[model samples]
Target chain A: MTDITNQSLSEIIDNIKTKRISSTDLTKAYIKNIESAKKLNAFVTTTFDQALDKAKQFDAKPNFDQLLPGIPLAVKDLFCTENTKTTAGSNILNNFIPTYESTVTKNLWDSGSFLLGKLNCDEFAMGSSNETSYFGNVINPVKDQLVPGGSSGGSSSALAADLTPATIGTDTGGSIRQPASFTGTVGLKPTYGLCSRWGIVAFASSLDQAGPMTKTIKDCSIMLEAMSGFDKKDSTSINKKKEQYSKNLKNNIKGLKIGIPKEYRVDNMPKEIDELWKKGKKILKDLGAQLIDISLPHTKYALPTYYIVAPAEASSNLARYDGVRYGYRSKKGKDLIEMYENTRSEGFGDEVKRRILIGTYVLSSGYYDAYYLKAQKVRNLIKKDFDDNFLKVDAILTPSTPSSAFKIGEKTNDPVSMYLNDIFTVPVNLAGLPALSLPAGLDKQGLPLGLQLIGKALDEQKILNIGYAFEKNCAFKNKIKKWW
Target chain B: MSLDKEKIKHVAKLARISVNEAKVDSLTKDLNSIFKFIEQLNELNTDKVEPLTSILNQSLRSRKDEINDGKIREKILKNSPKESEEFFVVPKVVE
Candidate 1:
């Protein structure tokens, strides 16, 4: 069977322009594939009718000539879709049918993209693995029993498994990056506010960002151009002028100063990932880029710092979801307090509740100074470490994750072990910096190894240029639908 | 005082959780371990370190506070499990 997805975005666009394949066929293929791979649990809800309807409606009148026009793309459940169920993979708000569209989703629809479904995610985007989702864990398309990293696991798994051409996912601390790494897909977390958070459910307000997850750097860039822009509704949204991300794909990385943070090369790194990083460094040198040693000494404190800060913000932001406002409510209670208590206790998953408790405790008056305040200082140091290093190097490089996907149940019992999943990706969030994860190479297990590139805030085009240039030189596997 | 049972209860109540008696021992142990680990943060000489709530080094930006127009109250309340007369109904308390 010819792999429909192996074709790049440019090739797909050309084919669609010539009417070689209609949008209806493309949408049907994905819907069929998603149905076949339903066992992967890649989506919390599949919008089969909606997908076909959008595909046909846009074909009659496409908005533009973009690569993704009439092309089907899945959406992570975290991004609110108007009149569509957006569960964020949690039961508390499982019935949440948003009347408004997230800026990202709105832009996608405006670009004439078709919707596939809402992919599963970590409950409230809280876990590194998708297991915490009330929808059940998304199994890795690569290795069935292992996990697809989360909370964007469903989106990555959908793309990896050939369910859709691309998808959009949110990264708060590493939701997009880590799962992309695990599933061997390209995921970008632009500067904290580069993409508006106006419609997506809040996790960690300061760190949450939305970006594209796709099969290649070029594809990721195309989708990102459609999703990113200024929004008056989202206060943190940057008002900078925008351009097509793919417009700068040809920018050469010659003489680029690439910084390798020495602190991330800790003792426990898998030899395979370390070897992949060294090989990636060599590849950049071969392309005429210079790799320099850099320091981010405060990285060791990042996980601790992120846990405190993210949860504190999450606690405050999630306060709106009380039983009186929206979402699941508890019945069979005598008093208001009992109702509220039972509702939250029964509604939230173990991981979600644990985070709430941790957040509430840290923000409490007595412990606030010791935990949250101190964490804030460490957070500044982490950002400062990046600022001082970025002054010398145009971009920073790090392993997207410690290792490839672990088995589904391996670390589910140990919450701390799971939080460690964000170590490499958290500091960038702390600094409100832009980062991209591309397939650097494959490890011994033949699973993909993801390499992350960090750029200055709102410098997404630079990272886009860097990612596209690297993909041009690197030998990337054609995205096969069966691989998922 | 070793985070006594009463303190745990208070904390759980503040968090609006219903911790069953059987789960208390395990939760206590877990919290103790986590707290002990976080105690290492106290080791840093952060006397001069300034607390930062936002990563951006820019000054705060605020718009004049005004009543903003918002709609779709029915849409917002659609997720609620129980409602009455267009308002979310909860168990009554005090009187």
Candidate 2:
């Protein structure tokens, strides 16, 4: 038998359709692979029995119409999977098995995708590194014990390691793209409201968007097409006619205007990242795309604004996780007040608690106007920067992170330094635009460094098309040597 | 705008989270640094900018408010840490 686990998602789907590989056999191979790669800690919960059973179910009666019939894929634990434990990589919800499915996951299953397991992530999608995951840190497949960028770290790790063919991830601030850049996988943080946020565990209501992480851009487009739709359940879900992004991925980039923001040139950035950005611009330029040097003046303040807005929303959203409902509660509480306090104090990790405190402080009476409201207004300015740029350029290109993946415990002690990793990626989230991280080149350490393509809201196809053109031309080779 | 221990404790209290005394000193430091970092936003002059609550500038679509959901009492209560019949159990709120 061929190495089914090594096959790209599209290839796996094709093989299943042609009866060259039965869904059961393919799923069994992945289950074996996932079990052997346990040291990576990519998966928080493995639905092996469920996956095998689902594969068997699909094999019994193959459905040709289903987009991902019998294909095993890992879901970020952030998405609520009914009856399956959806921890969101936090101890607070370690036993939180939802009674309903998140719309994104529902869309995937409706397309005949079988669940391999719930992938690990940062706690409530808070940290830049997966270290904050209550389940423990996800090990990078590229190097032993290196950090897979987060809060969607496991999603990126699994895709890069080929433990699962494809996975879904949510990006609040660089969660999807940074990890993808770190692990040498492709991640797309689609335009806000592109995918419904109906039942995905809310981190930052305004910023969080569910997107796909895959080995190839083509797989990303297909998975994205399957995963997106408007839902009445999510008030923010955009009710626009969906585009066939996969079909519209034009390999030609002739006359496409790509913007290179001057503001992305920060102090003390790795020289390789600058070279990679230059390389990306050159590739687009060679393809007959006009590379314009533009200025997003408000870009410098994006991170600070993101920290304020995300934490504020997160604090509000996470307030529902008190001991009263479905999540964990403290065992040593004397009264309701004490119970609430104890439950949160005990259940949440330090990073999560810190964010909650920051959120509460900002939204509190005295500082609301100065901090929370000011952040919101500044957020508008950030969005306006992109809005103004989009009138001139079709898409914007920049470095995904300042550099490649760092070691597991590199910046864990310093929260501010860890937050700086998001400097390049947060602006897109703040502006509610779709963006993708493409592996452009590798650094001196042989670690994957990536470039981002930011597109106007609902212009996912444009970015995908641009990314496709780059992928075909650049041919960035970053397949990791199997160490496990 | 440096966050001190007292202010951090107050914020924690408002958030309904208990921060241990041992951790308060460090939490104060973390918040102060983060706050100091975000103070850069004050440099930009915004006299008339509106606070952007929603990124997708859309109106909230409303339907006739009615009891269309929540009939599955058993399923909804399935994951409750403490429940009695159909109600979620919590620490006593009233005497």
Candidate 3:
């Protein structure tokens, strides 16, 4: 008998429908796996008792018509789960149990899935290595001491380790893709506004999007279908009908124009990553897709622009975490002003404070024009680069990150080096475009490397199809040996 | 263009985060390095380009102005650190 925990989401659904496995058994398998994989430090909060009860209820009344029938999922801790402790991997939010549910999680529940646990992430979704997480660094299951790329590190780690069959993560500048790249898994950042920002902890409101992290492209499609929709509460939610991505997934890529961005080939990029990108392009070409050399001229400026824009918005958004409201409040401080300062200083992690400081400096009165406004203008140019390239190409192809997973403490000291990890993934967020990162091959170190597919705004179907085609042909069969 | 200690302190104050006295120098160094990296944007001429405020091209949507939700004061104050009679208790703001 196959391990129930090792099955993909679609297979699990099929088994449930066929009465081969009940939701209780599936949930128990995952819970047992999670209990054993404690070295990864992936879960911040596990709802095993609640999960078992829900799974038992689901088994009692099997609903075969739903998208994710009787399935249990662990999501990133960033999403506010009603009556569950929702920490954004920060001391500030360590005690925040939201009274209401985030729209994305609610949607997943509506589709017949229940929460298994909350996974750890970079504090306030700020770091690339998951080191910023107040809970602790999430160990990449690929190798011990290697970081599960962050701020969606725990989501990637949990998915890779089979602690959860499938999971969801919020991507603000490669939070999903880079971790997915680090771990041998699939992560997609949907077009901005596709997933509502209603109850999720706000980072950079514009760039933050919640998407799926799964074992396969098919599972990704299934999870995305359940996780996205229009919510009236989220002002930026796209007013469009729900997409049937899982049902409509097709691998036919004949005559599709895939753009190869010249700018993504950053200097000092790892040789194996370059090889992985080349291999991805070749596989796409072999499947009858036309690869065109394209130039996104403003790509080099995207990282710097993102630094300005994201932090600026984050500084403003995070201001709501004063001592008065929900979350950690400082014991010291005589006055309201001192209280606010002390609470934030003691509550937030180092990286979060650094970003908040940078945000404040840029949005300050004297430097506003030179920093914030200039970055926004540069952002427009970055977006324009994608818009122009999309005229000649249906989707763009690039390596997800410059390198595979680094050691846990390798780049934590140097913030700039850590920021560069998102160079390839940030521009898509800037353009508010949908992109998918699929593990294409493994490096010499036996670590996984991913190739990214960027689609035009609201054209997620195209990228999903391209990724699906690439996944079927590439045949990346690397799996992590369970040492943890 | 470099962020000095004075500037870091001022920014921290503005952001309502107090920097530890011992860590100010290192924080300044990190901020300076980041600012230096961000200075690359200055090289690119973006005078003609408009600042992008929103990614979606559509104008902001407005619905009918009506009170849709309320009366969940207990729920709203459930997570508050210090609440008294539906109001959040804070340190004295008035002298």
Candidate 4:
């Protein structure tokens, strides 16, 4: 009836509460959609038979008090799901199945949501495009050949294509937000440690965070409320009580001071992006918000700093893949050391290898002071920029990316160029701040362009409110003509 | 700040990842370009700033040291590529 797959997560919850649609019916609808949209290459593994069984069990004894009730969601493969193959988009973990569940996924399951499947992502969440995934690049549902921005590319594409109602993604330097921008959806990278990194595959320990990607901001707030909490397992998790983000979401942002950082007006930015930024400002101002011109001077150093810090941590975190306890092991090695070398070299993809090499180089004895430590200090400056700016403003606004989504292989040859895709989004991660990317408008080619709202650390509610107000008032309507 | 083939090999060895002889040249070039970009951080002066190891300024929480979990030996061993009884089988180290 009227495409149950097209309804938002909140609406689906209501339909289930009212007994209008059975969980089995909802699960079947998504399965049908996912099967037809196989060309998108979004799902790495589909658990349809198990999903239907769970749905039937849910429908037999429905519970209305739970947040998700009886929803089935496909999560990004970086998370460790018990008894399920959680690949993290690398051949290294292709045959690996976990006996434990990631804290974030456990929280979702407790909220009455079950797994639909594991979605594809950049190997170890290393690249800006989905091309780095060993499972192959996920096609943007918006257009053929265009990348659905990545490591979270599969999550974004699946949501945008309506294969799953709502999904979760991990953001390390814009993995969640950038892809959300590309695919015309809502993605949030909550402050670092908001969601546990316990069972998730480690990328950069300091930067990796799990967040929700949804079709609407209200659904985003709802999914976020259900997913985030204090977990003793994740040392960095905020030990405070969970926030009632959806209930507290009020769009009246009158007199709220929103900062427009001057440094974000990067050199050679597209005219349409600039126009979108201006339009965003006007919408906020009209909604009774004050737009202050602010400066984040160290913004220029963020990407370079991130490249150093992330890879350094990544090299260390990834050293565990020795082919000893779990994952892929090479048969060709002559001895223990040789086996370790062969397994990593063979299991990892090119982008993953490049990062590992960079990580190894930066942390190497001679280069430690010049590279890793220097970047860490510069990282402090980047954080201080936001810490100082948050004093004068409630939130900061910028364009999500310099431009819209590019072709899959567009910047594969140039790592630095691909890294530049996160220019506007990286600084937030470096500072351990929360930011949301909202689909604001379309570019000249009709590809979706997003506007980012950056909030202070632990201030997700403020940005969500501003984004909610902007989403309601902005002229942009997110409609993708389904060519897939 | 650039890496040569020999240095790339050395770093690959340190990282415990094998680098094929044919791939070393391109890997060196790619890594050199990334380093070239990273070199820009040198322009900023961070002399007095302490390194940011963790974003949360609070001290790590300490819990009483005690056994919290056990009895999942089979479960943990189930994921190993080569398991022998209760342990993971590895290449022999003792000569």
Candidate 5:
């Protein structure tokens, strides 16, 4: 039989349904690939024993009609997985395990999906690069030493490496889309509250959202449909009915209006990124989609605003890791206060600490109104900018990142430069919008580049449809020539 | 907006995270540079916009206050650093 890992998820599903391949066989194929590609460090922990058992159970009683019956996939380590270690790629949570599974993962398991492992990510989903991971940086599968964008770096890298057909990742700023762009995988950051955040590790609660990362937009649609819904456990979980995104993804682009934001053409943008944007516009135009130039005037403030808002919320959310309950606790503390200080100081990495300090500073008594409140107000304007544009356009298009993936150590020393990696993706989170990044083409170095399709709030179908149409036209080949 | 060493130490205390004495200088420099970058947001005029706490405008959903959940004390304490019976052991506060 053909290499099961090489086929698209949809094809693999069909193969399983037709009895051409057993779920166990497919699971083993992925396990072998994951074992061989250990140098990529995509996985913080692999659940091969559990996965093989699940595959065998599924084989004993096959049910291919379910959404993802026996389909092996991975999840970013941020999600809480019961009976398994669920580190948010931080030493603070190095041995932390949730007694309860995250609602997103529970939804997948309920749909008969199989879990391959917990993929690595940035510590507490803080950094733009996965270097913040206490477990170590997840290398880009496309080329050695290059970062597979983050804080969902491991999810993107694993999918790109074919360790698993699909994976799940969280995006606070650009964790999902940026990494997807970097690794040539499709990642969708669903609308805020679209997927329950109850069991997923919190990072900037308001901006944090869980979404799917897959090799194809169709797989993204299917995964999103299975993973999203209302949950009473989470107050922010949207109460509306789950969208039938996969069913609605007809790839019909005729007469659709796609906005190209003028402010995205920033100064010093790489020439390759500009060319990719133009190529995306041309592809959409060729498919009968009308392209319109638009303006998001508050775009320049987005990154700074995100810096304040995300860290402020993260500081509050992460305050729970104070040497109580679980995770790493410093053993050399004299008392409770010292214990809390020691645990956090030793537990968190540099980037996580910096964000916490910034958060504490912003939310402090004297600076609250000036930084936190002001950032929130600016966030409103940014949301309004998107709301106004969506009135005239079905979706918006922009380059996923300013450029392709860079080396892992390239921007680690400069926090501001590292933060700029999310320049294009932050606004979407600030606006609580659903957006997707799919492979557009490769850059001069043969590294993959992606273009983002942003949709109005809760209107994920429109963006998925547009992406489906564009994917057909672009026919971007993303399979990397394995250097690992 | 330049974060001084004292300011960094104060903020770290407030955050309950320790900053090594040796690392304090570099940490101060990093914070100062990051703050300088973020201060650019002051340029945007935003005197009239309301602070948006949630983009969906969903009101805080409250349910009846009742003990409908919580019984699996064992599962909850599975990861405790030091546990005995149903209690997590921490440095004594009362003493």
Candidate 6:
């Protein structure tokens, strides 16, 4: 066994198809790996028995059409894997299990993808650093000293460590992209509503979307094709016909217009990051991508606008955890009101509490017009800005984060500074566009600086293809060879 | 930008979350700093700008209303400190 962790899902499936590796053997290998490295903390709960059962069911003449048939992949804790504990990194839902499945998780299983386990995330997907997770942070398998960029930190960590080469994660605002940036792997946040939300835990309803994170852009593209589709259960799920994300990978960047937001080159940006981005641009230019300067004039206001909009919606969405519906109730309350208050007070973490208060205050009767409504309007302007630029270029380029992964406990107490970690990636979510992060180059301490590509809605293939071309041209896979 | 002690209490109550009075001073300080930062948005002129809640600028389709029983009663109660069959046992509400 050449460390099956080194093989992609396609290679694994081919072996299983040719009977070179039994599906049972493959399933047992992943399970053994999960049991052996419990310290990685990647999986919150391993679906070992369930995965074995699924592998057996498929062992009798498996479906070859299902690209990932019998291959194990993790699901970020943010998604609802029916009957499995879907804790979104908070004690609030520590015991919460749903009877229904999220469409993406369900679809992943239906595509013959066997479960590896549920990965950890920031509490309620609130933090840019995975440290907010109540289940203890997901250690970067590549470098334990660094903090995994959050909210989907676990997904990226698992893929980078080869816990599983693939996983599904939700990005409300850079949760997926930023983590991928830190882990030096590929993560795609598809066009808004490309994947249904019926089963994923809600963070910011308007901005929440589920996408794939994997070792390579090609894996992301394949997983994305299997994931994106219409689901009536999710009203926001789009009705767009299924399109192969890998279809455009062969397309050259010849005459491709790549828009670079000069505004992202902030004063405090590290010199190494600046150098790496310039190098990434040079690689793209060498392969024929024209780097054009464009302005997202509203860039400065994105963090504030996102803060207002995300928390306001978060305040409403999280209101359901009133101890009546799901989650813990206060043990020492004298009345219903006290019960509600105490239960929530103890259930939610500090960042979650901060967001809920901000959300509620903004949406309350008197302030709704002043705060929530105004933020929504600015969101529209932000999207319009992107819509305007997409007509001029193939995709927008920006830094995935201000810097590479910050050290643990660096800014956890300062919520505002933590929120700034996603500044460059937030606007794309606000615009409901497709975005992908690829390793451009590494920094002085060997951390990666990632280049982000933002495409028009549903044209995920264009950017993924661009990423594939750049990956080959820039030799980022070689850069990443040091990590894996 | 400055949130007073009373207003902080109101915001906390409205959010249906309880914060310890001992910690309120620090939280209030933190909240004030954040609010001051967000107050920068007040500078933008937007007499004509409509607030946008969603990035998807499409109409929400009208669908016939129906009831759904989101089963999780047992799962939801698993976290309760005290519970009985069919309902969450709480302190009686009568005066």
Give the lDDT of residue A91 in candidate 2: 92
Q: State which docking tier applies to candidate 5.
A: high
Q: Model 5 clash pairs? A: none
State how far residue A121 of model 2 sits from its true place (Å). Answer: 0.4
**Cα TM-score of candidate 1:** 0.96
Residue pairs with colliding backbones in model 4 are none
Q: How well is candidate 2 docked (DockQ)?
A: 0.84
Which of the CAPRI classes, incorrect, acceptable, medium or high, describes model 1?
medium
Q: Candidate 5 residues A240-344, lDDT tens each?
A: 987888878898889999999999998899999999999999999999999999999999999999999999998999999977899999997889999999999
Root-mean-square deviation (CA) per prediction: 2.0, 1.0, 0.8, 0.9, 1.0, 2.3
The DockQ values of the predictions, listed in order, are 0.62, 0.84, 0.89, 0.87, 0.85, 0.56
Q: Which residue runs of candidate 6 sit more than 4 Å off their true CA positions?
A: A478-484, B64-85
Can you tell me the CAPRI class of model 2? Answer: high
lDDT of 2 by residue, A235-270 (tens): 888998877877777798899998999999999998
Worst 10 contiguous positions by lDDT, candidate 1 chain A? A475-484
Candidate 6 lDDT by residue in tens digits, A165-187: 58888999999999999988888
Clashes, model 3:
0
Give the winner by DockQ: 3
Q: Model 5 chain A, poorest ten-residue lDDT window? A: A475-484
Higher lDDT: candidate 2 or 6?
2
Off by over 4 Å in 3: none
Any runs in candidate 5 off by more than 4 Å, and if so which?
Answer: none
What's the distance in Å from true for residue A247, model 5? 1.8
**Pairwise TM-score winner, candidates 1 and 3:** 3
lDDT tens digits, residue span A1-484, model 4: 7999999999999999999999999999999999999999999999999999999999989888998999999999999999899899999999999999999999999999899999999999988889999999999999999999988999999999999999999998999999999998999999987888889999998999999999999999999999999999988888988999999999999999999999999999999999999999999999999999999999999999999999989999999998988999999888899999999999999888999889988989988999999999999989998989889999999999998999978999998999999999999989999999999999888999999999988999999999889889985666776787
